[model samples]
Target chain A: MDSKKGMKRREFLKKAGVTAVAASTAFAAPNVHAKTKTYKWKMVTTWPPHFPVLGEGADDLAKWITEMSDGRLKVSVYGAGELVPAMQAFDAVSQGMVEMGHASSYYWAGKSPATQFFSAVPFGMNAQQLNSWIYQGGGQALWDELYAQFNLKPFLSGNTGVQMGGWFNKEIKSLDDIKGLKMRIPGLGGKVIAKAGGTVVLSAGGEVYTNLERGVIDATEWVGPYHDYKMGFYKVAKFYYYPGWHEAGSSTELFVNKSKFESLPADLKAIVESACARANISMLTHFESQNNKYLQKLVNEHHVKLKKFPDDVIEKFRTLSAEVIGEIVEKDPMSKKVYESYSAFKKDITQWAKLSEATFYDMNK
Target chain B: MDSKKGMKRREFLKKAGVTAVAASTAFAAPNVHAKTKTYKWKMVTTWPPHFPVLGEGADDLAKWITEMSDGRLKVSVYGAGELVPAMQAFDAVSQGMVEMGHASSYYWAGKSPATQFFSAVPFGMNAQQLNSWIYQGGGQALWDELYAQFNLKPFLSGNTGVQMGGWFNKEIKSLDDIKGLKMRIPGLGGKVIAKAGGTVVLSAGGEVYTNLERGVIDATEWVGPYHDYKMGFYKVAKFYYYPGWHEAGSSTELFVNKSKFESLPADLKAIVESACARANISMLTHFESQNNKYLQKLVNEHHVKLKKFPDDVIEKFRTLSAEVIGEIVEKDPMSKKVYESYSAFKKDITQWAKLSEATFYDMNK
Candidate 1:
């Protein structure tokens, strides 16, 4: 695994503006009293090294923490497979193998079904409502309670605001079109497709492009136009769909080892939390700003047909999504508890949104 | 003005975990090297003391900076009229009479017409789109350049997401209904009212309710449900309107004296900026989380009639808004430059929004 080069004590002292006299005297004696101790942390993320906005957000989060702490706390970031595989990030941080990990919470559904609600849900609240529920409503307390069981503390770090549905090889004119289709989709979305009589295939990020190109998969759900354009999905797929119902405004997380985090000095702790908040807004805005340009290219340059799922088809998926979530909640008590709060907050916020955001969009049009 | 209680040196040292021996040695000589110098600053804001989310957000921003800096920087927040009148916030921070100021940008239109674009505009972008343009697009650089001319550095600090239009005693059925109406609106919205052949009356936050009740003004616009409910506008007006086309997703700002900000140590500077970002999201989420409950109260408990402006009337406002903005750009070169960037970004993001956010809202419904 690649590691960041360590900052020398002399260089650190110089950069931190410690006087030579103070430094020399502190080092002169074995039991010399010195300034506060410095902490060096390792953060492992699920994205490939320097991958688009997701991985880049992780790097920026680390940098902001270090900068805000004035070198008193330094963090080195590792991408997927560098320190551990992408799927292993949860355990790496939970087991205290790494100080922190960055990934979507749904990735840890195997650890706890309740975790998926913290990431995204089919027909879930959008980014603003989700953030409001998590940060201001009781969502954070529930998230904390859930993660504490696994010895982790989670922070809402970034968001992919209202992701596109996916790249489709054919138009989804009705529910019948979903039958017998072989598609690569993951998480609850995959289950919904399965319920609709489709064969769900699994493909890694690097392999999805080749799978679609070679007809190994009839369709694939990736990120929106920005990342999809980079994946060259438009080159392989004939049509793209709108309103990612399966993963609306999916939130990304930074999960740190609870013990390691608690051991931090108050300033470093405050600095870390604030840095995550900054990263959250920074990443969402970054995506919103660039997605349009890339979307334009996908439509105008690549001749990809942009299509909306049929209203009836979307209604079917909505019903299937409810059934999928209902079954999970029926089986898992924690999922029930989390989903109760999630659904309640979603209901109230959606009403407000209808009058506010929804009306604003409709009026402008 | 109330000030934050100072942290005693001994308490600060104990809290920061400075070794007793080091403290003794540092205090032994008058010329002893200290850990770092502390900064105590005053921040004047444009809201009443502890006014719901807006004023409370300023308090939180100061606390975060102090916590992150570990007592190296302590900021005292003063409400409007405590240090200076609400409208004088710009001059206070710009002239360095105060280290910082918090208010909406449009409050400074007399100082520069271009400043209004940074806050909100009639039928302009929403919160997500505005943030996209300002933070990631080239809007920040232009803002920095504009604020630099006034010796201030500004940060987009908070947002009131998709505000409510206003409370009206008379229903607005068409463009003719707006004529001869006296409304307590401000800035560009007031200008639009004037263009619609209405009389625009000026009233402070504290007087809006009384004005509407006494028929001094026939209508008034406050913030969204959370604040408006507290203001008891429902008790005074019969019809409440929706889709605040005038100030949709209005952004608030924190302006710091450029020279004072530059003088801060690197860590303190980073701490302050991150604190503002944390405050930005915190306030927006706070509003989003609570507005729905209060909105339900207004509609159900008090029977406030929630109304949407008629489509034709809204269209007329849109036309007039364009003309008003056209006059501004014609008169001011800075407004032209900023509006060019703002309008272009708005056009592109609005297109993307149609496919993403707008579609997501529609599909869910």
Candidate 2:
């Protein structure tokens, strides 16, 4: 490729400056600090330290940056309750209490309702479609614009593909089965479940297993098979339902303090950005692999009954999902704007998906 | 986050080395040449220069590396037939004639039949499943083992997620409709089509458009909407099919000369790997957006008849796909080993995908 034609005029100037730097090395001493600067950063996450996949992703990102930058940058990751409370991750990053944060965007829905779109929506984009939308469609721009108000720069770090619906102590054969059911669910899903006459209870991860086991909560949706299996939910819940409509494809993000991110050198900035992308791919693959492995173990070894949410119940949830989404859009102007962009992207991408991914899977199955 | 607990012993050594280097700056004047060193490398790709998404991905990878390394690594890309023919990319990189090569693994099937599994297989894994397998399910380790035999290191750099079946001159109503049909298709897909009584012909990309128009080939399977729309296939082929079973999710890879890769400094090596990961995410997202956009254009403006292959026809192809795959395994021991790994991964991932992606789509649709 012709360097002149390939590079823009501004890039040409940058290249020329680099060439001059190479020439100047023959005479002058190097800037030692610039050449081997070490940056120590603190990253706060929502998951416990060393937790599988999700927490491991945070550690992987830190390790990758440290190794990739040749120790120029080191990130120390703190789990929930380590440096800050789990729910306070967003506040920590936004307030610059930490240099970085590893958390799902929806955790900050109270701060900005639009934040939910960046995480997942009920009956919305799946993992692949989410990646396509955020990276290629206009999702990232809108995300950046929305988060700028909070003084945070966000990057897509990891994804928990499509989460399972939930685990139930009894069969959910009809819409009537959902009524008055105390289920541990959260986000828009909880809202939809509540609208469907089910009692939605907010439960911590640690409390979820016992609540479901003791009939305190009749059902609970933790992640997919991998984490759920580790939590031993299958031992108590006989009916494991799937097609998590609430958090279809939950996207986790890396939140950087805008000013701190801007202060990094060009190389370090790229390192951070690329490391996020690597972790994004890595984490999802890890979840998919582990979930598949443990899912088999749950069914074959543990005798967990794999069940799909009945058609009528799914239909009810779908209808409620649409209504709940509409209500979310009407809450505020930012929600409306983000919802509009999101819905438009979802609609367009879904058309292609229906004709492509949906068809492929249907044919193969 | 406790650094003592988080950092491994090996990492501690690396960090200690950096700390010493930082301290030594007080005594040494400078290592000016090391600080300003630049690496100029050449990359050869299968697509023509500046070709949409595929070729652009190569250019993007090069640009990302250069910028990420702060001009420490500058890559010049040569498109098909510029430095070598399109099909010679693997050989060029393997022989160290080019430092890097951008191409799909399936093109090297003739060199090593096992290479086909790395690209796409008929009735095989979709892009998301492919990513999970390659990145998490030991696919990359096998890939490294396979490529190491040729002295090359491979990185999955791009993906065309769920390509369309093909463009047919006339409607395909049933299995009988495929009989004696001359089609421009290649790879294992071509073998499957031939087995189903269609006449498969090898044709170059530039020749495909004219060949289909002139009745030299009754149909052709180019990429999805964006490329097909640009190729003006709708002018001749009335039937545009859905769900490309042949190449379900085609993976494009970057091949680096193993010794050349080993020579890079720690940071530069990280820059290369991370830049490739960035390009992998970027290219797929680009394809998804452009394909979504152009698919609408093809249907609304160009009046392309979007059709799904009949269920019976799909079943026939599916049966033949299994047979073809078996024959492939029987060809060699390595092929058998790789096929075993791929099929096992496919089976495992498919279970999770069905419970998650499939169920979600079915409920919504």
- Give one digit per residue, the lDDT tens place, for model 1 in B154-271: 9988999999999999999989989999999999999999999999999889898889989999999888999899999999999999879899989899999999999877777888
Tell how far residue B164 is off in model 2, in angstroms.
Answer: 0.8
Q: Write the per-residue lDDT of candidate 2 for residues A1-365, one digit (tens) a residue.
A: 11232244225436444333222223222232354445678999999888888999999999988876666567889999999999998889888888899999998889988899999888888878788888988889989999999999999999998999889988888888889999998888899999999999998777888888789999998889998888889888898998787888899999999988887888788889999999998888889888888998999999998888877788788899899888878878988988888888888888888878888778655
The candidate 2 chain B region of ten consecutive residues with least summed lDDT is B1-10
User: Candidate 2: which docking quality band?
Assistant: acceptable
Docking class of 1: acceptable
Candidate 1 residue pairs in clash (backbone atoms < 3 Å): none
Worst 10 residues of 1 chain A by lDDT: A26-35
| TM-score of each candidate structure, all chains considered together | 0.92, 0.91
Interface RMSD of each: 6.9, 8.6
Candidate 1 deviation (Cα RMSD): 5.1
Tell me the deviation in Å of residue A87 in model 2. Answer: 1.6
DockQ score of the complex predicted as candidate 2: 0.35
